[model samples]
Target: MAILTRAGRIELANAIKQKSIYLAWGQGAIEWDTQLPSEPSSSTELTSILGYRKATRVLYCDADEQGEIQVPNGRYKIVAGPTPHLYCQFNYDFNDGLSKSIRELGLMVGTKPKASTPSGQLYFQPEDIEQKGTLLLLEHRPAIYRDQGVRESFEFVISF
Candidate 1:
C-alpha cells in the first residue's frame, strides 16, 4: 500500500463518517475496538507499521488515573478541549528478543501516530498525550500501507 497523502486522509475521513464503521486493531486472536470519526486502528497495525509484536495492549488515561487499565482493541470517542485533537496510548511489554529486534530495526520508541488535517498536512501537539477515558474524535480513512497497512487511518479532531 502507498503512504497516505493529505487529500487521501480527508476523503477517507469523510467516507468513514458516512459509513459509521467500526475499526479493528491487532491480529492473531488479539484485536481492539475502534472509535468512529477517527481511523480504525489495531495492535496488529502498530506491530507491522512499527515492525514489532509483543505489544500487550494500549492504555488510555486521564487526570483521574495514571496507569488505569489495559484494553484489548479498545475504542473510545474524542472529546474537544482547549486543544482539539484525538489521541490513544498503547502499552508494550516486549520480551527480551523482541526488544532487541526493535532496536535493530531502528524503530524509534514513543513514536505517535502520524496525523494530518482535512487539507492533508500533518498536525499534532506536544501535550496530545494518550489518557484513559479521553475522548478522541477521529476522521476515518482507507488504509495506506499494505499487509497491516490495509487498516484505515483516522485523523484525531478533538480530545474530551
Candidate 2:
C-alpha cells in the first residue's frame, strides 16, 4: 500500500485547517468520499496521491452512528467483523503538541491486552503541516477464551 506522500500530507493539513473531514476507505488505494458538510471542495493534493481521476467512484456515508450522512444521494450500510482492535486514520494537522496529548490520553484510557492473546495495531500518518503529529486512533477489545463447555461472543462496530 502507498503511504500518503508529502504533498498529500500538506493537502490534508489544509483540509484540517479548513475544518474539512476527508474520508478514505480500504487498506490500500483509499477512495476519497465527499467533502465534509462544512468544506466546499475536495483536496487536489489528496486526489493526486490516490491517483484519482474524474471517473473514479467515491462512496460517502454518514459519520454518525445512524449513517445519516450520505453522498450520491442515497443511504448505505457499513459492516464490520469481530476483531481485538479497531483502527482508524485521520487527515489532520497535528501541530502544537496536540497529537502527543491525544496519544497520551488514549494510552491512559486504553486497556492492555493479555500477552498470550493476539494483539492488533492501527497505524496512521498525520499531515506534515502539523508539527510532530501522527494520528493513530486505536480501539482495543479484550480477548476472550473459552472451551467446549462455554460459548463466547465478541462485540464489533458495524453500520447497517
Candidate 3:
C-alpha cells in the first residue's frame, strides 16, 4: 500500500489553483431523467454544453475551513490548517442559458482562447473557445429550467 504525504497534497492543490478554471453548464439530453449515464471520471467534456465562465473566486485552505477565507481584506485573521482543500465559486448571468433546461455541470481546467476571441471576455459560449479543457469535475441531475430575470450561482469544494 502507498500513502501520499500532506505536503504532496498541498503542492497538488496549489498547482490546480494556478490554472485557469471554469464552470460549464449544459442542457444534456431531454431524456436525462431516465437515461443519463453514470458520471465517467474520464469524461473530457459535458454531454452538451450551453456555455461556461471563469470561476468568480478560488480559495486555498485547510480541512476545518480555516487557513484561508475570502472575506474583505484585513477583516479576519488567517490560519493554515492541517489538510488541504480548494473552494471555487461561480456566478451566471441572468440571460445565460435562459429558456433552457440545464441538467449537467462541469468544472474545466486549462481552457484556451480562440483566435477571434475578444479581449477580456470572461463568459463564453461553446463556439467562442478553442479547447474545452480537461473535465476536472462532472455533475448530472434533474433538469432545472431557466427563466428570464433569474440568475444562478454554484460553489464547489475540492479536497486534495
Among these predicted structures, which one has the highest TM-score? 3
**Pairs with backbone N, CA or C atoms under 3 Å apart (clashes), candidate 2:** 62-69, 95-131
For each candidate in the order shown, give its overall lDDT on alpha carbons: 0.26, 0.24, 0.79
Expressed as tens digits, the lDDT of each residue in 73-143 for candidate 2 is 34333324222122122322222222121111111112222244333322223321122222212221222
- What lDDT is obtained when candidate 2 is compared to the true structure? 0.24
User: How far is 44's C-alpha from truth in model 1 (Å)?
Assistant: 17
Question: In model 3, which runs have C-alpha deviations exceeding 4 angstroms?
Answer: 34-36, 65-83
Best-matching candidate per lDDT: 3
Candidate 1 has an lDDT of: 0.26
For candidate 2, the TM-score is: 0.16
Per-candidate clash tally = 28, 2, 1
Two-way TM-score contest, 2 vs 3, winner: 3
List residue ranges in candidate 1 displaced over 4 A.
1-84, 96-160
**Candidate 3 to native Cα RMSD, angstroms:** 5.1
Better of 2 and 3 by lDDT: 3
Better of 1 and 2 by lDDT: 1
TM for every model, in the order presented, reads 0.19, 0.16, 0.84
